[model samples]
Target: MRVLITAATFRSHLYPLVPLAWALRAAGHDVRIAVQPSLVGDVTAAGLPAVEVGRGPDFMSELKKSIDSDGGTPPGTAPSIDKIVVPHIRIAEAVVADLVPFAKNWKPDLVVADPAAFAAPAIAKAAGVPLVLHTWGPMPDQLWADLTSERTARENWPKDLVAFLDTWNVELGPDYADLVVDPCPEELLAIRMAKRQEARYVPYNGAGVTPDWLDEPKRRPRVCITWGTTSEFMGPEVLRPPLLAIEALAGLDVEIVAALGKAGRELLGDAGEQVRVVDWMPLSMLMPTCDALISQGGPGTVLAALVNGVPQLVVPQISAQPLGAELLTNSGAGLTLRPDELTAESVVATVTELLDGDSVRPAARELAERNAARPDPTQLVATLADLAAGR
Candidate 1:
């Protein structure tokens, strides 16, 4: 079977699908990732074959522009969904123009796409293939539905576009997809969509070399502090949590490993000797040894900590992170602190609690067990194959 996996031009969006892409290839299916030209490097870096499609206004730049125009929302405040979805719709329109022709020529049997890869439904319709929506976590279903309706009318898109999507079981009116591959634990989800297939959240933080120190046995409880790669793209003011977290953890008994981009390091200059700062380290390789995780509430970091059964202190900085953090807190796996609520003392207190608390760790372990009970990506290959075969 031939599988075409599509994602927008973001590493966070692309990484979630990597394990599934690998699983399909390992199962003897032909797999190729279709992404905006800017993201080809990221896709190839993950050892997947990448096909660059349509070039135009980049999604991140447009989103940053919107944020700049809005004078920036406070930390932990989600921007209006249209601010997030409109740029994606524009990009998708461009990508679909290019991708439809490519899909016709390549003739993929199935199309697995990120939920925001708005081009996929049309491409799948054009090629007469099954479309699968792969979600990173809980999505704003009503927000997406509203955005799609508003955009379609404003762009004067064909009324039959939604009808064509319906042929594949996609209902844009309610933001339903033919099938959804969800990697989140059931308890954390706020809204459950129909035709959901559960998959384990596998950590894939791109390729990186593991340092020798990481392999050596730890002398004390190790806590990982990270704001994730996206933090680097923002201004310094947006990244106060990592600095506060470092200060909070500095005098603690635990060993701290801080993963910050060069920019982040510069902003939080002279992290004391108590903190070990690296420009990048694969969390998948590093989380196993950590007693707790302190992060800016990026989904990848939150999910990585959960899968590793590490209790977390989440200081959400932007969209979805706040909700993700709250879900973790509600699930008994972690705690959430808004940026305004964050302080060195508060971070220290939370980290200490995560390390010493019994309920949080056990709850994290239970979430991990629930995640593990979901079907592995390799196990999902047959389901995709069956979907491709129209079973």
Candidate 2:
């Protein structure tokens, strides 16, 4: 069987699909990733074959420019349709022109895609293949509603998208896929959903080497602080909160590891000996060694902490994070602080709770058990094959 998976250029967009790609290959089915030209290297780095389709600037780099100009979309809130969703739709229009020709020639049996990849449905339609929708992580219930909202209302679409739809010959719809493979924790996603296939959240931190710090024994409780990649590009001001967190966490006996990539490290030079700041540490490799985490509420980052049984202090920066952070806080697996609520005192208090509070540990353990109980990607191999075979 041949399976073609599609994603946009962003690593956050591409990484969520890696485990499934690995699953398909392990099961002996041929798999290929078709993405914008810039993302071809990332597709190959994950050991998956890549087919480039069309061109676009690095998605996040473009977004960064928008954010810098208009200011961020307020921490904990989703970006408005114009600022966020429309750009993606525009990209899809460009990529599908190239993607459809490849899909026709490759003749894949199944098509899988990240939520942001609007081209997948059209390619599936063109090839007469089953289309699978994969989510990046658990989303806010309201955000989920926005994503799954009314389709087939083509007349209501913005004029530009309407034209794009006509050109692509595919109707505008939320999640235009036959099967939805979702990896959100069930408790975090309580809203009734359609065509939902629950899958485990598996962390893919890119191909990485283990840091030397993991080799040393922990002399104290360890806490990881990370801002994922988007915040790094949003501007230097985004690093302020972590720097504030460092000040708050100082004098505590805890060891701090801020895995803020190279640019983040360069922005924050020498965070003292007690604070080990490094670029490019994988959360899947680092989280198991830590007792707690502080991050800007990215779905992948939050799940990485949860799956490892580590409690967290989440400071939601943008997009779906605010909702996911709220759900995590409600689940008792973690706590959330919105942009307005961030401070040195707040950061210190939350980190203290994660390390010393009794409420968080038991919840964290239970969430970990639930994550482990869910079928991993390797287990989902037969399911994908069955979907392809229409059985």
Candidate 3:
């Protein structure tokens, strides 16, 4: 079988689909990732073949420019749902034009796409293939509704596009996929929007060498602090100023691993020995050794921590982070602090609570058990094959 996996031009969006892509390839199916030219390297780095389908203005830069002109909030602050979906719709429109021709030529049997890849439905329809909507986290039906309504009016799309648009109109449903592959735990998910296939959230934070220190037994309770890779785009200011969390945790008994990018590391000046700052390390490799995690609530990071059974203190910076944080808090697996609420004192208190408290870890363990119980990508290959064959 031939499969085409599509994603928007972001590492976060692309990474979620990696496990399944690898699974299909391992099962002897031909697979290729269709993405913007900028994301080709990311796809290739994951050891997958990539097809660069579109060319145009850079989406993230345009989004940053729009955010700056609006002056409503800082760069990393979460945008309104309108802001989130419009740019994606614009990118999808450009990509789909290129994708349709490629889909016709390549003739994939199945199309697995990121939730935000608005072009998937149209491409799948044109190619007469089954579409699977794979999510990094919980489905945001409201955001999809807003996006579809705006696109339907603005694009005045053709009849083939209507099926995708109609998906947004339906209540409590997935947006035009034959099957939905969700990685989030059932308890943490906000809604079940489709006939679903549950997959465990396997962390793939790019291919990297595991550090020697990661294998050594820890002398003290370890806490990982990461703002994720988006911090490279948003700049260091996206995190709390003056490195409040690191400063506050200075005197604590715990060892702090600050897995910051170059920009984020530069923002921290002369931190104490207790804080070990490195530009990049795989969280999947690092989290299992840690007692707790302090993160900006990226779905990958949050789920990685959950899978590792580490309690978390989430300081959401933008986008779906806040909602993810809330769900984690509700599940008793973690606690959340809004951007405004983030301070050195707050960080210290939260981390202390997470470290000392027994309830959170037990809850985290429960969530982990639930997540581990879900089928791995390798197990789901036969089901996807059947769907691709129109079974």
Candidate 4:
């Protein structure tokens, strides 16, 4: 069977689809990731074949600039639904023009896609194949959209997206999923969609190695801190969390391991011999050794921590990150701090509270166990095979 996977032009969006792709390939199905030209390398890096489609701009840059131009998100508010979804829609539209043609040529039996990858429906419709939407961890974006759409048409994806794809000859709608694959624990989700298929999360942190420090015994409580994955494209200003995190917990006896991107690594100067800063280390490996995690609320990052049962302190920056922050806090598995609320004192207090108290540990551990109990991706291959074979 031939499987075609599609994603928005971002690593966070692309990574969620990898596990299933891996499962399909292992089962002897041909799988190729269809993405914008720039993301082809990421697909290949994950050891899958990539088919380059239409052009797309730097969406992270566009998102950063859009947020900056609006003077950042309001104190109590996240960036608007349009601001977040529009960039994805734009890139998805760009990929569709080429994608429709490719799907016709490849004639994939199934199409697996990121929920945000709006182009997949057109491909599924064009090729007369089954389309399945896969999610990335806690999906606050969809929750927010569902809530906001109730009050205004602007925030509704199915309505707005259907109208947006008017030019395409095929019948396309955002509601076009034959099955929905979810890896997130129910505790982390606020809203549930229809036709959901439960799948265990397989973390795909791009091209990596096990660090040497993993072999060393921890002399104290270890904390894993990261700036999430999108900061490099946004530039240095977005790299402040790691610096502030170091400051917040400076006098504490905890060992800090900061996983940063290229910009974050450069921005972080010498933080003494106690701090371990690596440019790219998978949190899946690091979270198991840590006592707590502190980072921005990117679904992928937080889910990595959650899967390992690590208590978290999220500093939400953009889009549905705040929504994720709220759900985590409600679940008692984690805590949240808005950008305005972030401070040395607050971070220290939260970190200490999570570390010193056993309050959230049970919930965090339960959530992890529940997520681990979900059907693995290899198991989902049969489900997809059935869908492809019209079962």
Candidate 5:
């Protein structure tokens, strides 16, 4: 069987699918990823075949432009409709058009998609294949509906704007997908996505092949700071404060490992000792040894920390981050701070508390065990293969 996966261009979005894609191939299925051309290298790096879809500035570049024009830092909220949803909708349409010609030729048996790329389901519908929606975070269906209703209800929108906004809600009706895979956990999505018969709560997909470094010794209590793939679009103004806050913990006995994406490196160059910036590191390898994580509240990062039994301090980038952060806080594994209210003093204070407190660690360990106990995705893929074959 051949499977086609349509995902956003971001590494965070595409990376989670890599393990499962490999699992499918190992089980004798041909797997191909349809993503932005810019992400081709990453797809190939994970040893998956690449299917290029769409033409536009890379997703993050367009996002930066959106911020630059919108004035200063984005307000804290669920990803702004303009920032994430609209661009993705455009990218989805472009990706669908890009994939249609190939779909006609390749004739894949199944279409797996990241929900943001609405066109994947559309393409699957056109090709008449089983559509599987893959997610790293809780899929916010109600929030999506609210956003759609708000846009359509806007009397201020120009006629053309109203039509474009209506396009945002196109995926809401039937003909969406056959199944939705919430790869995080059922507990995480219980409040947000609820109990939908179509939804399956699988474990995290990209758990990563453990690296040899896990056996080595290190002196500094390693601290990981990351914002994940879309960090480039999320300006440093929102992220830097947290780092400065960490730096305020100057005398704390920890080595701060800031795994910055490209944008973070550019913004906080040579912050001197007590801070180290790497372009990227495989968190699966690094998180296990880390003492604590200070992050911008991306779900992927939050889960990585929790699954590794590492506590976290989240200064959420937006509402989704806060939502994930809130889950962590509720689960007793982490803490959250507002970016606007975050100061170096607050960061130091929070980090000190998390590191000094015993409860967070036990909570983190409990969460880790819970995550580890979820179904292995390789087995799930085997089952999915059977379903796709109508077994």
Candidate 6:
């Protein structure tokens, strides 16, 4: 079987799909990834065939600009309902245009797509292929409301964006998906919402496949801190506080490994004796050793921490981060602190609180165990294959 996997231009979007693509290939299916032209190298590196979609822009630059323009809120900061609804439509429309031909030409038996890359489902409909929508993040209520209001023309988005996304609604409304894989656990979603779709409970994407670096034993309690690669651009300024805060916690018999991207690594100076800074490290590997995680609350990071059974402290930079932090707080697995309000004392206090409390540890352990018990990727791929075969 030939499978075409589509994802948004961003790395966070692309990485989750890689493991699944590899799994398909291992099962003797022909697998190809349609993504931004710049990410062809990453796709090829993972041994998946690459198909270019968009004329690539510097993703980090675009993200930084968006974060700057959007005014990244500190942790625990919530976005106004309006901001979430409008901008995403514009971004998705632009992304969808690039992806259409890629999907049409590949004409795979199945198309697996990130939620943001709504174009894949549309193309699959047009090409008479099965579609699977892969959602690795929160399904925003604002987005649902926007889609629901399509008929009445009620939306918070600008006229241009609304017009663009509406085109897909008109083009592929009924023939959308055969299946939807919500990589997030059911505990994350308020309720299932898709019609004629099965929502599978898969663990966070790109999580828990151990890397080669973590086999070494360590003396101190290890703590993993990373604000996804997007944070490098969106919340570069937000990076300083976490680094500084960690320095203060150096005395607590803890060892810190901070995964900052290129920009973050440069900005964060030497991380001293107990703390180390690296340009990048696999979260799947680092999370298991870490006792606690400090993050910018991106969906991937939050889910990675949850799947690894590591307690977290979220400093929400933007998007659905505040919501994630809220969920963490509600679940008794973590705390949320705003960036502006963050101090060395606060970071130390929060880490101390998590360590002292049994709830954070046990809750995280329980959730991790639940996620670990989920059906493996082979089962999911077979289920998707059955959908494609119209079984």
Best by TM-score, which number?
A: 2
Tens-digit lDDT track for model 4 on 131-231?
A: 88898888864532353333343345555465555555433223547888989877777567567887788777677777777978889999888887656
True-structure lDDT of candidate 3: 0.80
Candidates 2 and 3 compared: the better one by TM-score is 2
Over the stretch 1-391, how does candidate 6's per-residue lDDT look in tens digits? Answer: 8888877766677776776777788889988787777678778776778877656454445443444566664543434544433444444555567666666676678888876664575567656777787766555544443443344334344455446545655332322356667666656553354542333233323323454457778787788778776543344665676677677688687888877777767776676777778777767667767889988887778777888788988887666676667777877778889877788888888888767776788888877777778765666778877888989
Cα lDDT tens digits, model 2, 1-391, are 9999998667887998999999889888999998888788888999999988867545665554555567776653445555665567667877887888888888999999986676787788888888888888875443245335445345444555556556656534454567788888876774534578888889887888876769789999999999888654455577777778877899789999987777678877877888998887778899999999999888888888888999989888766677778889999999988778888888888888889999998999899989888888898888878988999
RMSD of 3: 3.8
Per-candidate TM-scores read 0.90, 0.91, 0.89, 0.89, 0.83, 0.83
Q: Clashes in model 4: which pairs?
A: none
What is the Cα-based TM-score of model 5?
A: 0.83
**Superposition error at 216 for model 5 (Å):** 3.3
lDDT of each: 0.80, 0.79, 0.80, 0.79, 0.68, 0.67
lDDT of 4: 0.79
Candidate 6: give the clashing pairs: 75-316
What's the residue-level lDDT of 266 in candidate 2? 87
| TM-score, structure 1 vs. true | 0.90
List runs of model 2 lying over 4 Å from the truth: 56-79, 140-159, 166-175, 190-192
Candidate 2 lDDT (Cα, whole model)?
Answer: 0.79
Lowest lDDT 10-residue stretch of candidate 6:
196-205
Q: Write down the RMSD of all candidates, one decimal each.
A: 3.7, 2.9, 3.8, 3.3, 4.4, 4.1
